[model samples]
Target: MGVLLTSCSAPSPTPAPRPKVAVTTQIKQLLPATVSNKTAWSEDIYQAFTHQKLETSVSNLCSVIAIAGQESNFNADAPVAGLPHIAWQEIDRRAAALHIPAFVVRTALSVTSPTGKSYAERLDHVRSERELSDIYDDLINTVPLGQQLLGRFNPIHTGGPMQVSIAFAEQHAENYPYKKGNSIRKEVLSQRGGVYFGALHLLGYPANYTVPLYRFADYNAGWYASRNAAFQAAVAYLSGVPLVLDGDLINYQDDKPSQTELAIRSIGFTLQLSQQNIHQQLMLGQSIAFEQSPLWKQVFAAADKKRGQRWPHERLPGITLQSPKISRNLTTAWFAQRVNQRYQNCLLQSRRE
Candidate 1:
């Protein structure tokens, strides 16, 4: 008692906190020598982690660095090889669908724009997404014929070094640190905005993945795609219903239940869940909370018992990536694996230093 009292009375003094090192120094060690403007890249990346309160651990940092490297070898507005051709094609396609004649559309674009160049001329020389966006903005605002032909629609879905979804950026822009530009789309085309939003999209969500590969897949596919794919696997195992394993639990746009949802409904009697119950649970599929839901637990449990083995909860979502930009066969698995290789290389580089 006396010794305890003495120890309590003489409590040790707390050591001073270690001085913080700049994240740029750490980022420099991970970056390749070929990366231009190393300081700028590092600063934006550092601020991304800082603003989002994400752990700037080597693994996390490397993941962001790898994705940026993969998406655009560090260019803020990386030029698309055939953006003008792509843009013109899309414009003509849109006009055709709207029943607007090609010559009328062509004549409208030939008018002098605010840049003192014809819109068609601007489209001809456009190399990057950012430049295309500005031209689109001017077209919609200035030209009466442009509003009739294109309306408010700008088909550019993604931009910037990370090529983040403009829709995703706008939805998550409330917490964006930099208060630049009126539009999130414009911000997404900048270095700071791209990294900030990209990092958030990459690491903002929670997952039970043991490896970063599933998370990488989720990034390409969508949030929680990996987990939902595993659940679909379990459902397929339990019900003898073949599923696409595409990680889509519900068809948000369609009123009819999706295949995965219907599959779960087929075995609802075994799960003691009704179709409504199944759907209610399926609605949570987009979130981490879905992992803890009763449907997730029951499906896996039934599947495990039937097979006499536990099914792995994490699996790469099997999805073929389709985009106007893509000219070859590429899958979500390919993107995930490629980025993961880069991620591992960054880690290896950091270790070597």
Candidate 2:
């Protein structure tokens, strides 16, 4: 009855159709001004950002650009300085580990690959990681010794424009938009696939770090490494036991709690949590929920009381980067700092434009 007499409110004027933000266009616009290969980089990165559904926020975009700049200088097929030597070294190391004769390993690589060149030949001429990865693929598929020597583990752990983990791409490839050619390893070496997977790995996880610096560290170290490192600091403070501040809570290879976990447990009576409770909470270290646990809160409270001041809840993990490729002593803090500097530069570039 009221509807018949009262004038309609005209459907609230449809909220004026709030202007749609053109993320792809924005990315394309921003990327060209920053990257050297303006058109190509913009197109590939835009496609990647769109496919992954990652936020096109300036911070997120700059984070990706910063990592790519530091990793490969935005070259998808970036060349390693001594990749051939590195490949040979890996082969020799693997052979020695397996107790396989060097002659046999040499003979195995001598067999012609699908590309009609011997794997040894490919290795000798290898310049970029993509080339090396292709050779490994050929060997793994065609040679029996390849399976035995490598055992399903590719020595080329990291690849692509952003140098994302090949294993990470393989694991999170459920919604991959590319065709399954060869494997995720090959796709990770491609420009579009690499950026997509790398961006997903870098920005995919939820973090509550106050600064992007922590996220940058976590990107190099591991997810939640920054937060876990802070936890380690707290445990160290409360127990007066020195801890490495490495983000690992437990020994990943076994069910035992790590030194950090042990130190945290030493204060369990004060925390009002049992050993099992601490273990359970620390087990969730890979996730953001660990920050909300009683262990996280109690440890920080106790440590802050001891220090007479509150410690910053995030810090660069004290992990020494151990990789065959690394020639210098590099820590997680160093990597994070470098990336953050690049990230800040990118932000400045964006603002200037």
Index of the highest-lDDT prediction = 1
Give RMSD to native, each candidate. 7.2, 7.9
lDDT of 1 at 148: 67
| Candidate 1 TM-score, true structure as reference | 0.93
Question: For candidate 2, lDDT tens digit of each residue in 1-353?
Answer: 00010123332221121122454445555553446765566666666666665556677778887888888888899988888999999889889999999999999889888988888999999999999887887777779998887786777888999899888888999988889687888889988888888788777776766678888888888888888898888888888889998888889998767998899888899999999998999888999688789988888888888889997688889889997778999998999899888888777777876
Model 1 per-residue lDDT tens digits across residues 1-353 = 00010113243443332223556788988987899998888889888877776666778888888889889988988888888998899888888888989999889999999999999999999989999999888988998766766778766888898889999998998878788667989999999999998988888876667778888888889998988899999999888999999999999998899999889889999999999889999999999789778999999999889889998888899999898778989999999999999999998998898
Q: How does model 2 fare in lDDT?
A: 0.80
* Candidate 2 residue pairs in clash (backbone atoms < 3 Å): none
Cα misplacement distance, residue 35 of candidate 1 (Å): 0.6
- How does model 2 score by TM-score? 0.89
The residue pairs in collision within model 1 are none
Q: Report lDDT (Cα) of residue 248, candidate 2.
A: 88
Off by over 4 Å in 2: 1-36
